[model samples]
Target: MDSIPKKLYHIHRFDSRSGLELYLSGKEDMVFGEDFLKFPMMNLHYVFSRGFICGNLLIDFSIGAFIHHLYSASNIFQDMIIMKFNEKCSMEVRRWHGDRTGAFSWTHTKTSVEELEGKSDETQDKELNLKASIKHIVTCNLEEENLAHPLVLPLADCVISAVLLDVISKDEEDYMRNLEKASNLLKIGGHLILFGLLNTTYMTAGADRFHMMKYDESFVRSALSKLGFVIDYCAVQRRRNVSDLVDYSHVIFIAAHKEK
Candidate 1:
C-alpha cells in the first residue's frame, strides 16, 4: 500500500496582516516572537551606520511595514521611496507615516536604534525625523512587464531589499528575474543592499506558512556578480532565534555596487 505524503506548510498564500501583527510589528513575546526583528535589526544598523556611497534618494523594498532600518539611513539620505507590493500595505505605511490611529507602534524599534547609536536620553524626535524624510510610498507589482510603470519611478542611488526575494521568488528563475527588476530601478554605479535569510524554505506568518526560496550565500554572490555588481561587504550571521516562525539558518547581509 502507498503511504500518505506529508502535507506541505508552504502551500498557503502569504497572509500579510498576520505577518504584520506577529513578527514585523516589533511586538516581542516568548514563543517564535522577535526573531524576525533580532536578525536584521542590528545588522541593518551596522550596514547603514557607515560606508557605501552616500546618496539623496534611497529606495526601500523591505519586508512588511518596517521602518526601523531607516533610522540609521536617515542620517545619510535626504529622501526615501518605499515600494509596497499591495495597496493595503501601502495604506498601512501611509497610516504610520501620518501618525494615524491603529498604526503599529515602532517606538521600541526606534529606541533600539537610538541605543545602537549610543544615545541615552531621547524623545519622539528621532521617530519624527524619520517620518519627515519619507518622501513617497509607492505600490509595485512584480508580474507587470514594466515593474515601475504608471508611477514616476526614477532610478535610485541605492536600493535596499530585506528578505523580499526569498519571500516572492518561486524558484531560481523567478529569483533572477525579480533581481533584475530591482537592478533596473537602480542607477548605474548605484549600490544594491540585500538582506537574505539563507536556507529558508518557508516562513510561518501567524499559523499560516509562506514559501521562501531556499538559497545560500554563494548563490547570492553569483547572482549579483551576474548583474555586474562589485561586492563590497558581505556579512553572515548565524541564526539567533530558534523557532517555527521561519526555518532559516543564517542571515546574510550584502552591499554591492552595480559596475556595469
Candidate 2:
C-alpha cells in the first residue's frame, strides 16, 4: 500500500482576515515578522525608493490579501490594479479598500514603511493615495492564456507578485506557464518584480497546511532567461529565525524586464 498525500488548501480558500491577524499583526508577531513580513517590506521599499521601476500603471497579483508590500508602490505608480485568484482574497482587499467595518488593520505595516522612507506625519495621506490610485481589483486565472481574460485590461508598466507562484503551481512547467501568462499582462520593456520562497515544500496558515513548489535561484534564472526576460537585480535573504508556520529557507526578490 502506498502512503496518501495530505490535502493542503493554503491559498485556494484562504481566510485573509484571520490570516493577517495570525501571521502579521506586526508588533507582537516576532516569529512571523522576522521570517515573512520584514524582509519583503524592507526590500520592496528599497527597490521602489531607487526609482528604477516606476510608470503609469502597476499590476499586483500577490496571493492572499497581503498588501504590506504595496506601501512603497503607492508612491511610484499613478494607477494601480490588483488581481486576485480567489474571491476570498479579492473581497478582503476590497473590504480594506472600501473602509468597511471589520477590515484588517495595516497601520503597523504603514508605520514600518514610513520609517523605512524616513518620512513622518504623512502616513494617512499616503494610505489614502494608495486607495485612490486603485483603479480596479479584478479576478485573474493564472492557468488561462490571458491572465485576466474577457475583460481586457491595458498592459501594465510593471507587475509585482509576492510568494505566489511557489504555492499556486504544482510543478516547474506549471510555474513557467503561469509566468508566461502573467507576462502577457506586461508590456515589452516593462519590468516584472517577483518575491518567492526558496527551497520550501509547504506552508501553514490558519491551521491549514499548503503545498509549495520548491525551486532555487538557478532554476528561476534559467526560466526567466528562456522567457526572454533580462535579469537586472536579484537578491536572496536567508532565513534568520525558526518557525513552524512555513519551511522556506530564503526569500528571493528578482527584478527583470521583458526583452522581447
Candidate 3:
C-alpha cells in the first residue's frame, strides 16, 4: 500500500483577511505588537531613513509587502515593483492602492509607522507617495526560471523578501534555490533585505494551519555568505508570548548587499 502524502497549504489557501486580523494588525496582540510588527518598523527604519542608497528601482518578492508596514520606502526609492506570488494577494494590494471602497483597512499600520517616525501629519502624503511609487503589482512564481516570467521586469537595485521563503520553500535546497532566484533579480552590488520566522513548523489562521520551514540565524548567515552577499545589518527578536496564535521562536531581519 502506498502512503498518503500530507496536504500542505499554499498561497491558494492563504486567508488575507484572517492574516490581517490575526498577525499583521492591531497593537493589542502581543505577537503583532512585539514580534512581527517590530521586525519591519525597526529594520526598515534603519535602512531607508539612514544614508543607504535606496536607488531608483525596488522590488518586493513577498505577498502583502507594503500592505501593512514599511511605508517609509516610498520616500526613498524612486519606483517600486511588488511581485505577488498569487492573484488573490495581488488583488488585495490593487484594491488598497487604487483607493477602492471596502479595501482592507490599514489604519493601524499607518498609525504605528507614524508613531515610529514621530510625526502624524505626513500620513496622507506617505499614502499618496506609496500609491504613486508602486509602478506595478504583477503576478509572480518564485519557482519559475524568471520569477516574473514574460514580464521583462527590471533588475532591481534592492529586493525585499519577508517571511516568504520559509512559507514557500519545502526544504533547505528549495530555500537556497529561491534565495538564488532573488539574488539573480538584483544588479551587482544591489541590496537584499530579508525577514524570516525562526524555528517553527506551523502557523494558524482562523482555525486553519499552514506549515513553515524551520531555520535559524546561523543558517541564514551561512547561506547569504555563500551567495556572496555581505551582511550590512541583522536583527533578531526572540518570542515574547507563548500564545497559540502564532508558532515561532523568533523573528529575523537582515540587510545584505550582493557583492558579485
Candidate 4:
C-alpha cells in the first residue's frame, strides 16, 4: 500500500452510551495530543449495541444482532475501517445474522481457515480495495485470543484491539498474551489502536469481577514501544455522566505504527 491519507477503522459499536458514538458523531469536543492526527474517513464495525436490555437476553441477543444491523446499515466498500473479533464460530454466526437482517449476504464456513478467509475478504472488499487501491488500514479487537487468529494478523494494515474489562490487570498472563498477539498481528510499519478503562470496578452477568487497567498515555506508549510499535497518537478522555452504571472512566485511544 502506498502512503496515502490515513484511513481509520473503528472497532467499536454505535450506541449512545459508548464513547465511540460521540467521537464519530463529532459530539465529543476533545482533541488528540499535539503529535496525533485523524484518519480521512472513519468506518465502524459494531459488535454490540445498547438498544437491547442488559440482562441475559441482552447479552445473548446483542452479540449477533448488533453486527447484523451494522452490516446492513453500513457501506462495506468505504475507505476507512473498524472491526470487532470474537472466536471463529461467533464471528461466523454474526455474519449469518447480518445476512438475515437486511440487504447483506452471509456465507457460513465450517472451518477456521474458511471463516478467517471469508470475513477478511468481505471486509477488504468494503474498505481496502474500494478504489482499486490499497490504503492505510487500522483494526481494533476486544478479545485477546482473537488477535492471534490467522485471519486477523495479515489482513489489517494496522491492528488496534484489547482484552476484556478484567483480563488486562487481573490476569497478567492473559494481558501479556494479548500484547504478544497485537505485536505479531501488525506488519512492520503498520499501526495499532488501543482502548481501555482506568481505575474502575464492575460486574458482568456471569458474576465476573471486572477491574480496569490503570493506564495513562505514557504507560500505553511504553508498552507498545517495547513490542516494536511507535506511538503516533495518544488521547485520553473522560466518559460522560449517564444513567447506565457501566463505568467508562478514563477512555484512551492510541495510534501506533510498527517499526521496520
Write down the lDDT that model 2 would get. 0.81
The full ranking of all candidates by lDDT, starting with the best, is 2, 3, 1, 4
lDDT of 4 by residue, 1-260 (tens): 12222111113222211222222222334232111112211111221121110111001111111222123123322322333332332443333333434322222111221232355546634321322221222233445466433444333454435324222343444455656665665556655555555444431211122333444556566677677777655556565444223344555555566775
lDDT of 3 by residue, 1-260 (tens): 01322224444467666766677766464356767776677678778877664689989877443455548677788798888776767888888888888677767676667777876888767777778888999988665789888888879999988888887878898889889999999999899999888987777655666667888999989999999999998988888677765568988889999999
Q: In candidate 1, what are the lDDT values of residues 1-88, reduced to their tens digit? A: 0132222222334455666766666454634333455556666677667666678889998766777667777777889899877566
Best by TM-score: 2
User: Residue pairs in steric clash, candidate 1?
Assistant: none
Candidate 3 TM-score, C-alpha based = 0.92
Residue ranges of candidate 4 with Cα displaced over 4 Å: 1-97, 101-155, 162-174, 203-212
Candidate 1's TM-score: 0.88
Instruction: For model 3, state the Cα shift of residue 122 in Å.
Output: 1.4
| Residue-pair clashes per candidate | 0, 0, 0, 8
For candidate 3, the clash count comes to 0
Candidate 4 structure lDDT: 0.36
Task: Compute each candidate's TM-score over C-alphas.
Answer: 0.88, 0.93, 0.92, 0.46
Better of 2 and 4 by lDDT: 2
Clashes of 2: 0
Give per-residue lDDT, candidate 1, residue 129: 77
Higher TM-score: candidate 1 or 2?
2
Worst 10 residues of 3 by lDDT: 1-10
Reference-based lDDT, residue 101, model 1: 91
